[model samples]
Target: MRSVYVFPGQGSQHKGMGAGLFEKFPELVAQADDVLGYSVEELCLRDPDRVLSQTRYTQPALYVVNSLTYLDRTTERGELPAAVAGHSLGEYCALFAAGAFDFATGLRLVAKRGELMSRAPKGAMAAVVNLDEERVREILTGLPFRNVDIANINARTQCILSGEYDELHDPRLRAAYTEAGARFVPLNVSAAFHSRCMTDVQQEFALHLAGFDLAELTLPVVANYTARPYPTKGYADHLAHQISGSVRWYESMSWLIAQGHRDFQEIGPGNVLTKLTAQILKDPLPVETAPAPQPAPAAVRARPRTELVFMYGGQGTQYHQMGRGLYDTDPVFRDAMDRCDAAHRATAGTSLLAAVHDDTRRGRPFDDILTSHAALYSIGYSLTEMLRAAGIHPDAVLGHSLGEYVAATAAGALSFEDGLRLVTRQARLLQERCPDGGMLSVLDSPDLYRSRRDLFGDIALAAVNYDRNFVVSGAGTRLAALQQALDAEGVITVRLPVRHAFHSALLDPIRPDFLALTRDVTVTTPRLPVHSSMLAGRLGTRHGWDEYLWDVIRRPVRFDELMASEFTAPGRHFFVDLSASGSFANFLKHGYAPALRGAPAINQFGNNSGTVRALRDELRRLAGV
Candidate 1:
């Protein structure tokens, strides 16, 4: 079951919207205050200055409050979505979720964005209720209102029109919309957003965006400009364009529901997105008032028992002290790690355990391509063994990116020694042949190719994790430049920590070598059903396993299409993450229905033994064990 967190833009702000959250996340509030040079908590809770209604204050306050609400929710559950999206100002929060930038960076950007926007020429916007976009567009283009634009397509029938005050309030145009079965109500916005009137602001904002550092997206964030995900390469450009581009709220909401996100939580002041989402999906998301902030103990929910779908995590999910406690406390897990280390010692030339858990060489293991992949695979494989030894087994298995080797091995398609050799061999060959390059997880989708045809030098889409979640790979310098451009515009991106770019042209030099090495590796049909990220479907025997292994190196990971197909089938499935971090769990939540969501990672809180016990208890409750 996938869940979506939708944030509202300017129009949704209220006098006392963030009352419950300000006290809950005082640190974040303080950070926001520091960035804005004022007390955001006071503005949100008291609004004594009525500044919350102004565009400059509204944008930053909503952004901070929305971010805190999101942090609070995750603090309660420790899970993020498969993808994230927001309305105009709220997009910054979505970008934050995607790991494009840190919280303080987002606050500063949003504050600046608001300040710039508030300086725009004054205009008026009105909500034209019960009118479709096509009709509204025709009205705007054909008459004295030609200068007017459909600023926001909020729902199937609700369109927000923006232009000069006199034109928007013209008696004839308002009469025309009303006669056409629409209720036109004037809006209190200080200036036109997502309209041509903001052209200068867009350009100025782009200039401001050029200074910020945008990491690639960690989660998929649906961008308002394209009614899809923001691309990894052009973060600031899109946000800049968004100043004069219509907010495709209705289309964005429709696309998510069509992609299988059924549950939604509005993480801001009002239920604007929630209400609009209901209109788009033609079904209401259950609504409730904000609960007073309180201490939330670790929670475990039973019932709705389902078959397990174990997902071995890919790269970018590794961290220091990842499996440290398991190594010390669980003999089964430790033995598997030891065996993997000994087996791959010749090729790796280092201790796998030390690479992952050693405190001394903290950053080296993450930076070295061979070490990182080896650590990810060994930890995942060992965890799988430990889970099985504890009488926990999955009905189906899947892997993201390089995690496929572990999935295949666990499913009996390859032996442990062979899988390790295959992973190590591929890593070594790439390190030998490929120059240092980078992979950036962006928030845009494949539609980015057609919608925004701007060229990103040497960058290719590496993975389409979900509708909005995508990765681009290219040379290190070019990738860095792309990230900077995006960061300036407030588009979020995450630079995947790796020595060389995988699944990009950078890896082409080693393809032949990789294929040749894997040619002699043994292949067998899986003992359990296995899904392929490269194929975007179930692994089939029609092609030799050798071909699949090589294809994994060449093709983009189609995790979005693969998981979509899995959930379209009828039974409940728990997508449990067997990686170092539970980051993939958040991705799964945004892609599948809420019922399919599960833990991000065991021991995410660093209380390894307690977390393991809780996981076992939850599994037993789920399986009726």
Candidate 2:
């Protein structure tokens, strides 16, 4: 049973925060007093000169009390936590607890840190509640917001913004957030402490930081910048960047959850960190006005043994510049994408990276099946790797159409290089031999497609995503006519970006060539359970995988059939949608399955890294982590 000791930062400071701890650790308090050049106990308990709330005094005082509290608790318990973490100013105390530095040295450092941060330029910080990072980013991106950056991502819907005071308080800005169903509350701070506004302060602090040598950590200390364990070297760089960079508290906790840390103890004055920890570990729910719900029977409904299924979506879910953010922000995602790109370029003399990032700066609707097919495989495989790196392993895999190749690779039925080759060859065949057509998404029952012959007589049913959502493929003229007729009937319809009518007669000409290309490929039972789009249930001990693979694209997708069978099963199951646009999760959200829940691996909005962290936390809670 591993655990983490979390320490709160500046905002937790208050009068009498160190009441009993100061007396318990007299020697340490004395050392802190001398190092800080003031009575540590007095500033925390009395604040006689009213400087305790000031940044300089507040930091040192909080550090002393937090360290003392930690020491006292560990001595009484006869042990230390398996790991330690802290928020902003609390990081120094965390490092001290991990044996990275001595008490006096830590006190001296926080004192200097406090002094530098206190001298920062006038700025503002605001806590925006009830809006996710993606939605908040969407709101801010539309406006000309200068110097404003997100300083802290505390939870799924809570974040702190640090920037120029005027920009944060602009009447139109606050009004915009308010209109979009968010509450923005300004924090009492004078400087944009963890933003570019603190660059000058960070540089000066780095000069001071160069004077001391940090010791090797005795235990893991998750970093705020990387949201993972700190490396042995680069203490100065990590610390310097932290001063002027956003605090990824939410991501840090998500990483901890991935590491099998289920218990978190907040060793500080207030319960802010405790509240945040609880929020991060719990499943997010909407506010309801129905009757009160009964308590869960944890013993009867065990989640620790829950099954995890990774579901991958196919085309039309992708947009231009897909995965661009994760590529730039997450090293793990970048490495995985780079590997896939290398394989892609080696085989086809092309780069999925170019498909994802075009010369128009950002791309538009990318419908080139040659590139989109390969891109889908690359993204699906890369996301699986990213999730695995965060300790999320799929008990089974589900792939739709082109995504089946990725699933096959994940399940050990196909080699990564072989999978890439097959995908590119299939894309090429479809481009050369198939008729010009497209896919249309209809928001209606599958039965409607059968009854309305005039509308869908010539089109082929491609996929059934859920009870009321399905896709049809055919020539462009027929798709347009169907979309227009559906729109007139108040039926929601969307034209998918595709070049050919997949799963229809339009693609029959390419089957011979596609089969010939894959004739020499080996197919076997997957190491992990696979529920494919063409199958009614899990692929169990089946042979002729090559034919099955071909049928996966040529046959209509029966995702709803699989969902219908599995969602009603008795086992504890969690679906993790590894789609670029989160389409599968959307289906689960609306389907009338009892207590069915799912988490998406990526988002179309510019927050894939953070979104995946949120997904980890969300799904971890379901697995009883």
Candidate 3:
């Protein structure tokens, strides 16, 4: 049976939506609350005085409720419909169902959207019915006022015009619209929605959306503004542009009907779209006065339970004794590494692998010296290749500071050769800049340091893992000065291993050199999804290889935030940390334990055959191959 699921726009929210569902499905409610960092039930059911009625709260609240309802109802049934569509704010919900945008990104976009749209000037909306579409358009075109335009066309006989309150209240214009065979009814909306009044709001919204890696839709989604289907690459842009454009709802509905889809289900909050469908289908067709009623609604089905395999790498995961092993064992890994080594020499004016294997440091152990940037990149290259051979693909990838270069390689934005070159160059640059200092991971927020600013003078909080977990990096003399000051306040700090202040403004100087090196390189789009620690979102077209390499040096690592968002989805989500040691994997598990429990499983490989075999098995299991 042909059927489509449609979502409603704003003005459909109620006082106690999703309350009953939340009570019945506590797990779903808890999942959503964890993602949003608030009690979903409280936000949906307890806004007694309408404080939640504001656009920011209302849009997200409705979307969460609608999504949960869809999931619940669908789980109790059999299969999704053939098509999905939504009106304005509801379009995100439709995209989620269509697999265009995941739940977390959709919710985030909606929240940001509401906040942006709230900035629009206050205005009014009025529905004009029983009017010809052409004449209504002609009247609106003739209006001499700013911020006034057609908003929604519910049917061939109805349309909504929104604009300034004073302009809408003009007697002559109202009479002109009425004289053209239509009835005008004022609406209760606070601002004119879906009109030029919201032009500024739409512009800001586009910038935020530009950062995400939006994939193609697996199913068709009817566009609101154009009343047509849009390709995946431009979906986000189309949705943002629709904010100030007229919503051709009537045209959209007619287009669907013409496509031979007779069965439609309104899936969120209210049955507004369903009611409109009934009205649109009331008249008999030319062939018959009455056509057979559409088949019963199809049952909804839940997605399969996929295993969450977390892969960790250990210190021994390093190989020195490594380059030859990869060369002999896998051609792909060896070729990639060879190319990387060549790039390293070309960019840094030295052989990176030779530097990594060199044991000439005065006081440091050979392994310690080898584990520097050059060595790390070589190991990262080998590990990623090994995983590919084992058939292990990640749904999401995260890495600790140094390990992030590995994740970038896996995501395809950076080739193994390019990664090694960049890492080698970065390590040399950093070591040269700060030859005698080290970083300390303090378990405190920046606010703590800020509150007692005098006590932590010179020693700045480098990274914020969470409220209580932080990393502070500075020179030894500065650190000593700050430690003496903090000692008086009874606060202690732990020193991290190795050297150099990472993820601090102190690294700013590296930008110019890094940019110069990247200016001559050709960067391409990522083949797989990769989150940016610097941007706290998936890397976009703007972050092609060149920009990413430069940003890696200048920006603060933000993998923690990326991990936080990844764990928000219900059920299993895989995370692979490509490093020589399991250090990054352990850090992630400990740092995000609360969010990790819902994650299905965790795995690690520190240059071991057994771990490699296990990773292969897990990959096969997750991919059902």
Candidate 4:
């Protein structure tokens, strides 16, 4: 069987993805660092700066890791594959591996491409699932809307639509796609990519492409623009055109499968293209006319003993505009958030509305205790409402430190109004009374921390996430020194974007005032089970919201212990990460459970709110509801 190496694009990148690949090829990593004018390894291994999610840095880092993986795999096999292909940004790696361009030249082009693309005008992209590209095009052509374009033909049933953000989110257009038997989901991207909106960047990138010397491919590497092997000449034009041209990923894979290449090897971080290949191969084109669009006939019961778990995260997960995708696209989410904003105003807290939805404040750091704390509660509560509105009611909910506040509200331990008031008031107390401090994420066992106490002696254990993952809390001023010390010992460390050292003695100053505020609060038994990270187990007692909320703030987060106690059959649980960045979901991914797929939540990456629709569809499909 012939084999083809495929690389994934953006949306595949994740923190801690390139753990050892950089060390395997130190020389290449060093060269990459030099060309990129930054430590690519540092960016990959521990992006303390949190800039990896940005398009400009994401591309270069992905290219290096993908290149390293390709090089490593081929070296072990002592041979190259028959052909190579990549999706979107991954195509650069395909070309580089095929000897079309040398390392530095390819890196330069990718870096420039990322920077240009990052600057593309604000627009949107949506994945239209369950519809063929032809049908999507036919629908778009018939719609009264204009400027929309297909960005990626991912599979026969999954194509990405891009254009002006407003036009893409238009209800008439979405209804057309849905009426035609498809799921229209607006992605989390901030710009119109691979559409005419990228024309400006494409022209600039063409100039950048002309500056580099290119070479003919030694191995067949299919192009994203034409979906075939590159011609001997004008490689620059083909590379540049894909900027504004739709990626022919499905067709490219089909051509390979047509040649009997069934053994496909995914060379990069994610299984995105791999999954697309399986889908494309599963439903090879000329699809029998899809039966007319059908509504789910009847609501069905969930599997016996099955559950929906709402998992929440604390700080370091908040970002400006985290839930803007849903706020713009989903009315239920928007309405909940509007109520949250009204609460924010009534409570005299910071403008929660402007902090998250205003485009002007998009890139600014939202790590302050005032903004992050309230934002976390707002997004978490509103997201839960959105999920529950879609019939995905949580059977159990878990919270990590500040997450417990929102979780309590979600679990009915406290009312929404009370939860919002308490969250905002607590933020005020922490910001005003608690001295500045920070937290550190160490990707090693707690045993490491115990063994290296001399170095981490000043820091307090904040949370034990999983087996090898733990966090430490310390003074804000000492955070830098602690990170440097860990670096000297070759320990992986990430300074979580938090200003207050939560769950530590540093917050002792605010305890008196904090408890005073919650003392008069009323509570009720949760309708569903509520797990507490501080308690390290299921919440107990029928009341005492004051003590519970205060203990959540002042105690260490024993996340793993709580999870371990609950660990059972994956089929019995659905762990949904409701944090802005999917922190809880990322923490649980360490377990590699099949149920993780069912807990669809937003992330810092592509199509943030798209996952919400994915969750609804999965629940509807599985439960027939």
The candidate that wins on lDDT is: 2
Q: Provide the TM-score for each candidate, comma-separated.
A: 0.51, 0.51, 0.50, 0.51
Residue 88, model 4: Cα distance from true site in angstroms:
60
Q: 1-625, model 4: which lDDT tens digit per residue?
A: 5579999998899888878787788888889989999999889879999999899999999999899999899988988899899899999999988898877778888999999898887899999998877578657744544357788988878899999878888899889988888888888788888876776687677767757777767877877776667754435666877787778787777667766678888988978877887888886543112111111111233335356788888888877878888888989989999998888888864578887776776777678676678788888998999888876787778888888988989988788888878878888888888888999999888777756767776677888887788998889768788899888888899888788888778888877888888865677766766878875545643114566787787667878656644432346566778888877767766754453444547877758767887767766665655
After superposition, the stretches of candidate 1 with alpha carbons farther than 4 Å from their true spots are 1-305, 363-365, 444-450, 569-571, 603-605
Model 2 C-alpha lDDT per residue in residues 525-571, reported as the tens digit of each score = 46776777665345532224666767778777778656644334334
Q: Candidate 2, after superposition: displacement of residue 580 in Å? A: 0.9
Candidate 4 has an lDDT of 0.78
Order the candidate numbers by lDDT, best to worst: 2, 4, 1, 3
lDDT of 1 by residue, 264-338 (tens): 888888787777787778842221122111111112234345768788877777777788888899999899999
Model 3 compared with the native: what TM-score?
Answer: 0.50
**What local lDDT does model 4 show for residue 68?**
90
Candidate 4, residue 172: Cα displacement in angstroms equals 69
lDDT of 3 by residue, 366-385 (tens): 33322356666666666666
For each candidate, the alpha-carbon lDDT, in order, equals 0.75, 0.79, 0.62, 0.78
- Choose 2 or 4, whichever is better by lDDT: 2
Worst 10-residue stretch by lDDT in candidate 4?
A: 289-298
For model 1, the run of ten residues with the poorest summed lDDT: 289-298
